[model samples]
Target: MIPASDQDLEQVQAQFQALVMPHLDRLLGFASRRTRSVAEAEDAVQEACVRAWLGFAGLRDPAKVRPWLYCILRAVLADNCERDGRRQRLVSITRLEDEHEALVGGDDDAVLVEVEGRLTGEVIRAALADIPEDFATAVEMHDIDGFKYQEIADILGIPIGTVMSRISRGRRLLAGAVASNQRAWLRDDGKGERQAEARRAARAGGFDGGVTS
Candidate 1:
């Protein structure tokens, strides 16, 4: 790769500061959606940012910068997931797209309500903490951070098959945990009936949502 000129480096840094830094929350939200843990999501994004900074010189096409950053974030998440021996459960990025569409369609009020009713940061952190550390790491790296299997394998110094297995297993475990938590919530609350109904709805929507752990 050609070395980035000083001007190029400065421009990259400026772009990161302007466009990327402002999107930290959105990026974290995206990571959390995939990894289901606030801590892991934060870690994944942090690592991704670090990698992006280090590899800024490789990013020749300014237009591709956003996608490139996302790619790095995903790679970091994948690596963490693999190291954690977490089973990978695939989440559809469709919800995010849907939410964006809702916003664009001028349903701001509905979007705000949905956001308000969403899981809290504390809930995500606690759930992540409940998972095995290694599994959490792997899930954050592979799924949330968006690392490729081979890249994760290289990063974690594990076999590629091991990376795949960890992702698969971690996802399964996470889904089971989410199901169990929902059941527990139903049992503990007076609104057990309503909660149960919600769970049913989640299932109907194919929200077999799993995390890295």
Candidate 2:
């Protein structure tokens, strides 16, 4: 595409900031759940942002901005996955330790709470990564991002029934993965202790939907 005029560039940037910037965290979360690494997720979101800025003029309906951005993000992810030989890479949970540390920014107890929450998120993300791409995307968009079925279908360019099917299957697989992981942890004394501690911390903070004792 030709470079935008100075005036056009300014207008596009303004619209993008207004419509797309607000969804950056959600986009990053969505990408993170799909990607193997934080760097890859960030790359996908960055590419999507640039594409959105360039194509901002074509997006006339403000109401469709969120899905439009998602479309761009999805495409970027697909391209990256294809180029990487379709390998579903696992994220290193250790990296999350740093994020948890930054998030807690407090004494020991607060640090423990953040670690529990971070591990819960990591477990889910890892499970999602192991599922089929379509199924994982359906589950993440509908369940994690809180999009309606019809909205998911539209974003994915599939029928609503297919979206529902993918989500149901994906959720089943996710639950099995979580349960299996918890059982494995329980089998080992050291890991089991860590798992119990994390759950206790999560409970103290009133967090829900993690490995239950």
Candidate 3:
């Protein structure tokens, strides 16, 4: 049995610091939004980090590190869901492509705009809560995290077409939600307490959109 030398350990640690550490905060935030509990999210990310460190030597390209890390993190989450018996209902995507054929919606920009208006963060998260988790993730990844279609595909280990479909369908659903009740929120200025309560409820349900400067 051959143990890795100190030099090999030092090189790997250096590579990890340069390529992986930069993404730690974002990775934690990503896990936090997806997991049901803070403890779960932290544990999942910790597991993923261990996996990544173990596999660091197999990495072929430093540039692709972001997607690689996400792929590992996602696999951890999926594994947890399956063991907990929630995979069939919560993580299923077998029918997403088939359903993509039925996509009907306006441009992504229009829907994103509507969903990003004042009180829109709360509104968008609220609306996203009602849709499939897979679809919500794609939409939020693109609109909130600024991921490109191909990047999302790599991270999810799915086809680019599926990413497009999820984002499109998700936008359609969010738009409908925003338009249907948008006036109610805008029309009432005296409902500050109600709005705060709504925001609190939203914090419990889903991943928050990142604030773009």
Candidate 4:
């Protein structure tokens, strides 16, 4: 808390407004993508703001304020999950942290272009929702939000290596999801076409009155 002196209180408020207020919209966008509903996102961001204000005085570096705010927001979400008994899925044994660097991510650009070609914004969002939250957050922050590895690490409080792995794996998972969608769409489209063709044939007297095969 700011000192009891009115002058100190005013100074803290001014400092917070200057350093933090500009990012509110961006923060809300981030929270919205991470949450299930807009209402949840709004409540989370609002709570994050309140917590940020309360802890504003302890912040030493103004330059890192954006990631600091994100870290706080993540913590708020985690706490909510814990309170609600949401189980956090952790890394499987097959994906040890050491192997993250070894993932075949050299064609990252090529893969991204392909994925973009196959998916629309709505489809991309759906794909993101289909993956694990941990991987999705890392990928979204890096590809969509344009945060660097170190910045993501700082915000997530995880190692840079782990962040890299999650993104690599996340991209692969997202591509798979997109492909699955395409297949499903093709199947549905084909079924509709077949149904329409059958109707056309019946109308043309191809089925006859008995409709024998």
Candidate 2's C-alpha runs over 4 A off are: 1-9, 88-120, 184-213
Note the Cα lDDT for every prediction shown. 0.56, 0.66, 0.66, 0.66
- Per-residue alpha-carbon lDDT of model 3 for 121-194, expressed as tens digits? 55555555434567778997898767899999988879999999989877765555445444454555645335
Tens digit per residue, CA lDDT, model 2, 1-213: 655697787786676798998899999988766665578779999999999888887998988888899999989978876776554433233333333344446465553453344345545665554344566688888877888999899999999999999888666655544444544433435564455345433322334342211
The residue ranges of model 1 lying beyond 4 angstroms of the native Cα positions read: 1-12, 90-213
Q: What is candidate 4's lDDT per residue for 18-80, written digit by digit as tens?
A: 988998877887776555557888999999999999898778899989889989998987787
Best-performing candidate as measured by TM-score: 4
Question: What's the true lDDT of residue 186 in model 2?
Answer: 30
Arrange candidates by TM-score, descending. Answer: 4, 3, 2, 1
Candidate that beats the other on lDDT, 1 or 3, i.e. the better one: 3
On the 0 to 100 scale, the lDDT of residue 141 in model 2 is 87
Per-residue error (Å), model 2, residue 209: 26
